[model samples]
Target: MRKLFATAFSLWAATAAQAENCQIIGNQTLCDDGVSGQRIGNTTYWNDGSSSQQVGRFTYNSDGTSSQQIGNHTYYSDGTSSQTIGTTTYFSDGRSCRRIGNQISCD
Candidate 1:
């Protein structure tokens, strides 16, 4: 009976530890993978499992738009990079209409 009680207690303790190690925010689950930072929001996974050292960040706007900044890359709402040097525009149908510049190419 003592052995059984010890096993049950260990199981319960393990479960409680796991539950305390993670949090659910928005649609994302922030988990600490022992060495890394915590995760944040729904789309971003942070470092050492630490949310303080964010490895990635994603923001979804109310206008049916979204943006993501991962490392050195910045993504815009139109699924394009914000670092794009040339000027570009899109039509209502979600098609690239025009682009102009020496390094530019129209989509």
Candidate 2:
């Protein structure tokens, strides 16, 4: 869940319609999206007071749930999953986002 959340957040922030600059400072990554993240060991802590730990292909959330990524597909412990095809990602719940150049459009 955390991996998906983090990846989705970063990906969206990076490719949003409005240009955003991202920079890495030490172990932390800061972006114009107002979200900052620091990676310590396998755990990633965010400025929004959330964190996740990565173990192998799995990312464990603070709430005890987990998600795993195998290839371009991510599977959640709750039985949900998402798949990415090219620059487009499709979620099990029917949400999807597609990136074209530096812009991303989602629905």
Candidate 3:
């Protein structure tokens, strides 16, 4: 039971860390991970200090790699992806975060 509790805590901490880096400041959602986005109509335009180009729903990185969001699924350039089903966003890394009100809780 202790092991399970520890594991749960770790996952919670990871999710908290990710959520802490992100904030809803005015009209933009900003993150310390070098990504910020603003929704315009049906598309969310992302800026990472390099570009603000919106091709479909993908955000291109400065490294020539890009990440795209289709429906609720996000495809990253690193071959990893995440999907949002309901109020939760599940990462390819096995982490899942749930949106609670204006905050995110993960486990």
Candidate 4:
């Protein structure tokens, strides 16, 4: 499940939407309407309004591979977020490793 979770997180991080200048409005809420992605430096943010909100970042490696990262899942909105150092490394060889907290899985 590590790989799956990491892959999902990475996908969202790469394709999430940001509200141009999305900020905490009305008790930490944002104006994100989901399906839009924004990259402010190394941060990314997305919200589906229905409850799927994500925030993360990704980097394109010099070797043609890539990686997605985030400090932790602190933007779930439901206060049930439980992630630490979510990371997924995509190798140039088509292999990948996903590590969340202390669990590592590859596929």
The candidate that wins on lDDT is 2
TM-score rank, highest first? 2, 3, 1, 4
lDDT of 4: 0.33
Ranking by lDDT: 2, 3, 4, 1
Please write out the lDDT profile of model 1 over residues 1-107, one tens digit for every residue: 11110111110001111212333344333334332222233223333221222123555433344445544334556644433222332322333312222121222
Where is model 1 more than 4 Å wrong at Cα?
A: 1-56, 84-107
Weakest lDDT window of 10 consecutive positions for candidate 4: 13-22
Off by over 4 Å in 3: 1-21, 30-53, 105-107
lDDT of 4 at 56: 41
lDDT of 3 by residue, 31-105 (tens): 555455664543344553333334566554444655667787776666867777776667788767655544434
Question: Backbone collision count in every prediction?
Answer: 9, 0, 0, 4
**Model 1 accuracy (lDDT, Cα):** 0.28
How well is each residue in 51-96 modelled by candidate 4, as lDDT tens digits? 2222345334222334444454322222223344436544333444
Question: Residue 80: error of model 2 in Å?
Answer: 1.3
Q: Model 2, range 1-107, lDDT digits (tens) per residue?
A: 22344444332222243434455555676665676678787777877787777777777777677777788887777787778888777778776666555444555
lDDT of 2 at 22: 52
In angstroms, give how far residue 44 of model 2 lies from its true place: 1.2
Question: Which stretch of 10 consecutive residues in model 2 shows the poorest summed lDDT?
Answer: 10-19
Better of 2 and 4 by TM-score: 2
Q: What is the Cα-based TM-score of model 1?
A: 0.24
